[model samples]
Target: MKGSDPKPQSYEQLPLQFQLYDCSAGQSDCSQCRAVPEEYGCVWCSGTCVYNQSCTSVPADTCPPPQITQVSERCSVLSSSQMTCPTPAVTPEVKVKGVWFQLDNVRVHYETIKGKSFTYYPNPEFFPLNREAPDAPYRFKPGGVIAVEGQHLTRAISRQEVKARLGDRECEVKTLDNTHLYCEPPEIQPLSVDDRSELPCLKVFMGNLEVELGRVQYDSDSLSVVPLAAQISLAAGAAVIILSVLVVILMYRRKSKQALRDYKKVLLQLETLEINVGDQCRKEFTVASFPPF
Candidate 1:
């Protein structure tokens, strides 16, 4: 038991048939025998242990997100076009059956055409009428009801018509191609409201007669006959013109003042120089008479 290597311990001495146990369930295991559970191992086991032998459950596969598709078309007729009438040279007539009030600066004429109908002719010459015609025929047909309408008919005659009738006074005519026809008319300023109010409702001026056709009441406070934007623009233009005039006047005054000041300074300098030269000549003459050194 000492230096003779003490008899080597036999398997029986080391408990060759000792109880084997599963360590996973805290069961005791033999130190020398092999009775391991499915994947349970002992502390002395050298190989890799398969503790979790059951396969893991996987999630179901999902589909990818949907993609957007674009569609193209050509020459498709518009729904509005299909619903509306085709563009024709002769537009349909618009009937304005109501009481008509014709007003000018001097007089207001009311004509009630009971049960009358007029064919709205589109005259290209009457550009601002919003009607397509210049020589629109307003036939006062029978069977039309009328009501009271008021206001000055300022747009009875167009500037072009006035120019044509008057043979172009200080006015230039612009053609369809933007070409200008220049003719100097006798200078006639627009009549003021007061002056115009004194004139007859229907008057002839310079061989051109103006008649009041109809009047539409316009509220200066609300329903803007002339848009606020346009009025503001006109006001801005006027203010700019006034400011320009004031600047020119101020510049002219400043230049004039500067010129006057410069002229005075030059005159003063000339007078001083002349006095100084005279005094020096007198001193030289006095010195020459006193001594010839």
Candidate 2:
């Protein structure tokens, strides 16, 4: 009876299972569809979906912490050539965005390679060595070059931050770099001889810090500089004039001697003529004395 009751079966007689949807089949093979790893898989797509296989990941940004290194400068001098004198170090401090940093730190970078040995210091490319200032008397002259070396010159990294002073007078910065600064000393017209002010000292300021480079030697106006070129020209001109005068005198003397010789010849001719005339007269008198015998 149970087998023949199909038409009268209630809803409870239906099968409990439903057909499962094949997401990984019918469209493409599982090998071709490729299963994306959970780490990079997208949440909106089904686990077998190929659309979420590629994901874009952005890296987080980080700032390198500040580092401090030891610096041992042998000396600081106005001239780069002269490092013999053990002078004080020029330690300049700069304020950037309300934070202060040493010039040596900001201007230089320490680099180390993974497999390499020695530490590398990346100095500014334009940094100069063998720079020397105008010596002594010349350094006191206007527009004289004053070379500043052995210190970090680019503290604030701008033209406005680099400043130089020769005594109280401000100097024009001609060339600047991390290690060297070339400046034109202000035209210090020397005070009168009665003025007793000492020569100005060369001072350079990187930011608010100051470094005394050297003192400009006093140049005296009393030291008469006789121009050798002018003197030589004057001597040559005088010699030429004297030689010309001597030549003129020699020519005049030669003309005078020639005139004297002509005058003597004329006198001798006159004397000979007188002698002949006298003899002729004597002959005529003798003939007359004979009385035509």
Candidate 3:
């Protein structure tokens, strides 16, 4: 009976058999003919087998699957004991697409894949933008100084770098000595739908300072450089204001001189008229007194 119980067979009792065949047509009793089929069939086998007639093929090697790592969406809030809202996990496949920052210190980081992106906002609502809480116990002004620490900061970052990276983001930079630098984006026309829908932008900050490297903007249309124009307009406006002020001062002085001259001439004419009246009165009194003789 061929194992009627159908129990699992041991290695020694297995039905598997290995045999070797002579590869040479003329050789009948060669050592190659006696090679084991199971041993020499594949390169992984332990024994030799026929070169062509018997199994003597090599198998390919395969590697294990790749591993995936998870990135945290929520960054730690400085000095706050409470943890901020949970953020979505960032996958290796995700790429930074667009970035925007609020007037407050809170930063919003965005990432995208296949034209879709995710936003992660940090806790601690920034000031100036949070006007609703006027009497709130924790009122922070927009220009207050603050210090930040991050993984990649070598030195303090300026407000210009932050604006460049975050695109119209507003923040206040403070030195250790409490020197404040207010950075606000210039007011410009609104972006079109195409500009808003363009590829995602990323703004990375190390502490309070912004990272200058790896910053990129992918606008479909040409970049509208406005700094030069803004500067020129500012300069022109200042010059006009200064000139206007000078002209006003000069006009006021001229008017004051003309009024003073008119006052002096009126005073002199009044004195001359009083003297003439006194002389006429004296001459008429003398004539009246002599008329009786």
Candidate No. with top lDDT = 2
Q: Which ranges of candidate 2 are over 4 A from the true structure?
A: 1-142, 189-197, 218-293
Evaluated at residue 208, the lDDT of candidate 2 is: 35
lDDT of 3 by residue, 87-150 (tens): 3434333443454333268654434223445443332122222234423222222223222223
Q: Estimate each model's TM-score.
A: 0.25, 0.28, 0.27
lDDT of 2 by residue, 1-293 (tens): 55654577456576688644333443232333333244543222332333343323322122224335444334345675543222123333311111121345554222221333322222222212223543333334344576666544464345565677766677778888776788776455432222343656566665334665545654455334669999999999999999999999999999999999999999999999999999999999999889864
- CA lDDT of each candidate? 0.36, 0.52, 0.42
Model 2: how far residue 283 lies from native, Å: 87
State each candidate's clash count.
Answer: 21, 0, 6
Q: What is the C-alpha RMSD of each candidate to the true structure, in Å?
A: 38.0, 27.0, 24.8
> Which pairs clash (backbone N, Cα, C closer than 3 Å) in model 2?
none
Better TM-score candidate (2, 3)? 2
